[model samples]
Target: MKKMIFVLVYAITTLTIFSFGKAAENEQLSIALSGQYARKMTDASKKLEELDTAVKKTLLFNESDGSSKAREDIWRLSSDIKNSVSSLPLDQSFSTSWMNYLGRLGNYAKEADRVTDHNEYLRVMGQASKNLRAMADEWEVATTGMVSGKLAISDWTNRLDATKSGHDWSGMGTTVKQYTESDFPLTASESDSMKKKELRNMPDSEVTREEAVERFKKLFPSVSNEIIGVETSKSGSPYPFYHIRFAENQSIGYIDILEKGGHVLSFLSERPFGKEVLPFEDIQKKAEKFLADAEYKDLVYEEARENNTAWHMVYVRVEPRYGAKVFSDTIHLKVAKDIGSIVGLDASEYIRKENTHPQPITKKDWKKFFHANVQVVKEELAYVENERLEQRLVHYLTVTIDEHGVIGTYAVIIDTETSEVIKTERLQ
Candidate 1:
């Protein structure tokens, strides 16, 4: 019996030892496979890093003797990196940011290859570098987490700063900043006012349509010589303007003013394909009728005009109804040209229903959509002309949404007498 008991104990010990050994072997196999996969991924990443550096160098400096080859190589490297990274387990933040940066870089490289405008190409490349730095930071964080190792934040930060310094040294960032400062100086409100003044004061011409076409050719060399037709006279203005159309892909239409010393008054581009066309007046009538038919009892039309691309814009105000919340709301209608119909309408502030709660939304409502820490920086009022029966009272307000972000300006037009909103236009 003693011998039998000893044998049973020995058998149990041997089985236990065999099970433990098998588990150890499986773990070792997994570790080996993981290491091999990691090495392969690291090699691909190294190649991508090298390609990225070469592309940046070529873009920053006008280096030749294989710059085109480098550009093509970078595009292929980015694509390969995308495919490889997709197979790896990347979190949303890292995957999204890296893919976006790669896409932007690829686009920049393509543009650089075709671009004759050196300055524009440099500006695009500088932006690409900024985006890349952001992606690299995200990548470092993700890699550290995946390896379960602590990474030095300063290391990543310093690398990004160094890359930015290289861009600065090449004068790429400065060139882009200078170009932007010079090209886009005026505010949207100022631009709109200038366009309106130019249109209103355009002189009428007694010159024949043929003479008008010749004058237009001399004025605008960019547009091809193609006369679609001409309108002798229009109701809104006393002077006659020629309606000239161009080739399909070129500008859609242009108004050649014979009265305004034979100058091309305005040009319009084709709308996104398959859009209808509607006249300016017809759009205004439709908006007014829509508000009138609704419960908005006091619908007032403040301004209506034809914008670029032959789109008509109508600004109107709807007074608050009793037992309905909201003091007033502004409405804008975008009308299509092919048919006298409303293509788009924005009436966010003007929703009114009879059975709804009766108090107007206050500061709390505004806070829901706007940040609490917004700083009001500047304000300006539109010019007031007492002689004109139809006048606009516009308030230009500039505010900063966050502590460090672009200053946003908004144009708030109000009816002075009723304190009703006429229109709200966002400007950057």
Candidate 2:
């Protein structure tokens, strides 16, 4: 009996260790894969910009003196864009239409190039340009929204298929206009179209594609290359922005500039980080300068995490009187380790601001509601969204629960005005 008992205890201990080891490894893998996906998304957006620029250059460069070289650029760019899209992390089925459209565009480019008469070429490209621009707008809405919002891959792919136009790169047959012109035109799903229709009505701001490109140039003077093209946010977004990308030499980047007062929503770039390492404070200061230059006002640094490769800095907006941190209004910057050049930024949530609320008339001692074994760790004033998605002032508390032998950590939120328990979330 004693031998059997010993064997059971040993087996249990070994299994627990093995299981936890696997769990930890899985967690590390998940994080690594997530980062990889983000990097791929950044690259894909860069390709899109290149393709957009090539198409536009073809149409316009020929305007004044009719340069054939500009038209010739599209064949190569179209092929490159198709390859880039194919290389994305998504299943091939999800991106098949993208390739289909490029094939058509490539053919169109060749056809445009072969035409001998300048007027004939102009007339042909004029019609093609409108279709190309509209579809380009469609793609912008898809790819640019990812870099902002820290959007999930599943959510991104789901939206990609929504309200999409059908064959021959037709803008309609669905959303943009009448589909009567498209060969074998088909309808966009009704449900998807309505969702997009709803998003189209959401009030943000608007800028022409030209204006968006100019903003990109003014904001990042270091990048002398032509602006790829402007992409719009997904149709499902409440607040949309124009996404613009650029590449120069070994460097590639993209910026999300909002139409709402033309704010810089976010930007990400992949390039050789400088070899020189600066102090953490200096790196943070460099990030701060970038934010200021982007016209992001009323922000204060909150915290930071540093690794060998980069420093991830966070900033949040604080309410003046109560000094409650508005957690939703956040700005994040990832600066290459000590290089001080910002490699990533996500301030999409900060673009839309909510009016500050006045102090609540009622205040309560929230501690009385907890069990006797519950020990209050820390509490603070904060602005957090309640169940209804309405922003509310609350006393956000960190508390520990000791029930018999087991211990647990939790975040408890209490509404200041009504003293109602807003929500409870387990930390561990």
RMSD of 1: 28.5
lDDT against the true structure, each candidate = 0.49, 0.67
Tell me the TM-score of each prediction against the true structure: 0.31, 0.46
* Candidate 2 Cα outliers beyond 4 Å, as residue runs: 1-211, 224-226, 231-240, 274-278, 359-361, 366-378, 400-410, 426-428
Per-residue CA lDDT of model 1 for 1-428, tens digit only, reads 99999999999999999999998887677566555445545655575666557567767566433467767776777777766666654333445545555544564465454457776756665655554554444344435422332223333234335645222222433343343344223444444444444344433435777777676565334444665666655766534456665543444555445454454444444435345555566766766665455334544565556654345454434324332112223455555555544444444333321112223322222334346875556544432322111333433344555435755566544433434455656755
Best by lDDT: 2
- The Cα error of candidate 2 at residue 171, in Å, is 25
What TM-score should be assigned to candidate 2? 0.46
Clashes of each: 12, 3
Q: What is the C-alpha RMSD of each candidate to the true structure, in Å?
A: 28.5, 24.0
